[model samples]
Target: MAEQQTWPHHELGRKLNNWGRWGDDDQIGTLNFVTPATRVEAAGLVRTGKSFDLGMPFDKDGPFKAGGFRTNPQHIMTLLPSDTAHTKDGLISADDMIITGLQAATQWDGLAHAGYGGRFYNNVPAAAVNNFLGATRNSFHHAVERLISRGVLLDIARLKGVDRLEDSYEITEADLLAAEERQGVRVRSGDIVLLRTGSYQWFLEGDREHFLGNAPGPCLDTCEWLYEREVAALAIDNHSGEVWPSPIEGVTIPFHQVVIRDMGLTLGEMFNLEELAADCEADGVWEFLFCAPGLKVTGSAGSPITPIALK
Candidate 1:
C-alpha cells in the first residue's frame, strides 16, 4: 500500500502536529523558518533580474462564480473618467473599489483557515475565531512580513510530461521527490515551495468549471515530506492546495486539516505558475527569490497576494 494510505487522516494529523514548535504565542506558524539569514541567501538567487508574477488577475471573470459561498472579485468604479472630468486644473483622477472574498483569487490561507478537533495551530481553540472578529489567534496579519523567502518550483505536470495532470490525481511525496530530481533542484528549509500541476491553464482558457473542479494537487501524505523538509509555505496552481474529492475515506480536504492546522503551514492557492515554470524549464533553474506578503488584515483567515518571483 502507498505510505499515505497506511494511516488514517486524523492519525497523520497527529503525527505531523507542530503545536508549540515555535512558541506559545506563535501565530505565524512555519513562516518562522524564514530567518534573516535565509532571506539574505534568497536575495543572492537573483541573477538575470527577470521577474514573474505568479498571481491570477483579481477581476469579475476569475474562476470563482456567483451562487457559491465565495464569489469572484467584483470591481466597482467609484470614480470614473466622466466623474473626474468635473475636477479643476486637470487634476482629475479615477478611483475604483473592489469587493472580494479574501480567498477569491490567488491568496494565502492563514494558519487559522483550517483546524480540527475544535483547535487551531499551536493548540489555540477554534472559539478564538468569531464571526465578528474572524481568526483572532492565527490571523493573516501575523504572516504579512514572514512569507518572503526562497521559492522552489516542483513542476509535477512537466515531470509527468503533461500539460496538466488528470482530475483527482493525488500527488504524493514520491512525486515531489521525483520532480525535484527531474528539475535538478532541491527543496530546502525556509523555502516557499510552489507545486505546479498546470491546473490553472483551465482558468486561463476560460474553462472555469474545470479549473475549479477536481484537479491535481498534493496528497495527504505529502505533508510529512513538507514537514520533514521544513518548507515555510506552499503554493499550488489550483483552488484548493490539495487534490479534490479527497481520496481518503470519510474526509474531504484532509491535507488542509493536517498541513494548515497540525503543521501550521500556510497554503497559497489559485497561483498562476505557467510563466515561471516555462522560465525554469528554459534556464534549468528552479529556485528564485519569492516575495508574497499577505495584507495586514488584522483578523482575516486569509489574504489575497500578488506573488512575485525574481530570478
Candidate 2:
C-alpha cells in the first residue's frame, strides 16, 4: 500500500513550508500541485452546460468606500462625444478608462499579498514582494496560472438551517465536514473550495453594513485543515475570508498570517455565491468544474476575477 501522507503542523513564527518543494525561484506557491492532468480530470465534472458566475458587479455603487484602502471601480469615458470620429465621418468609436484597484471586487489574493514576521511566502521579505509598481517577486501572474480545477462548495448557512450565520461565528473543522456530508461531496486535492455563509444574500438585499462590517467565516483553526487537504485555493462571499473581530484575542486576523504566510495558500474574496449554492441545493451535488483565475497582470498584488463554475 502507498504510504499515508502526513502534514507537518507548525507553530507561529515557525512555518509549515513548501518553499523549496517546487524550486528556489518558484513564484507560484501551493498551486504547483495543479498539474495538467488535474485539469483533464476536473473537466469531467461538467455534466451539464449550466454555468454560474461568482463575481460581484463592480461600480461606484458597489461595496467599497470611494477613497478608502480599497475603493470601488471608477469608469470614465475618454471620448466627450459618444460617436467621436476616429478617421473619417463614417468611422466612429468609443473609448473608456478604468482606474480601479484589483482587489475591489471578486478577486484573488496573490502570493505577495500577505505574510507574517516580516517574511512572505517562501521566506522572502514582504517589502521585496511588492515594489513601487506592484508585486514583483510574487505577482498575480503566478497566482493565475493554476486556477482551473474541481470546485467544491460548502454552504455553512444551509447546513445550520439559517439564512446566515452570526456576525462573529467562526466556522470550524466540524462544520466543514458536516457540510461535505450533507452535500454528498468530498473536497479533493487540486480543488478550489468556496464557502457560503449567506452573507452575500444580505448584501444582495441591500444590507451593506452588516455584510461588510461583520461577517461569518473561517478562523486560524482551519489553516492546517486546508493545507493538509492540498487544496489549490479558497474563496468566500464575505469581505474577509475569516471572521471579523477574529476569535484570537488581542490580535487581528492571525488566521490570515497562518494560511497565506505559513501555508502559502491563495485566497479569493467577495465572490457572489448565492446562485451557485441554490443550484447545488437543487441538484444534491456540490462539485463542479471551476475555471477562475486571476488576470495575468504582471507584478500585481491581486487581480479582479469573475470565476465560473460549470456543471
- Report the poorest 10 consecutive residues by lDDT, candidate 2: 4-13
Regions more than 4 Å wrong, model 1: 1-7
Sequence-dependent TM-score of model 1: 0.95
**lDDT accuracy of residue 246 in candidate 1:** 87
Candidate 2 per-residue lDDT over residues 191-276, each given as its tens digit: 88999988887678887777788788997667766877888789989998788877655667666677777667788899999999
Candidate 1 clash total? 0
Best by lDDT: 1
Clash counts for all predictions: 0, 0
Cα RMSD, model 1: 3.5
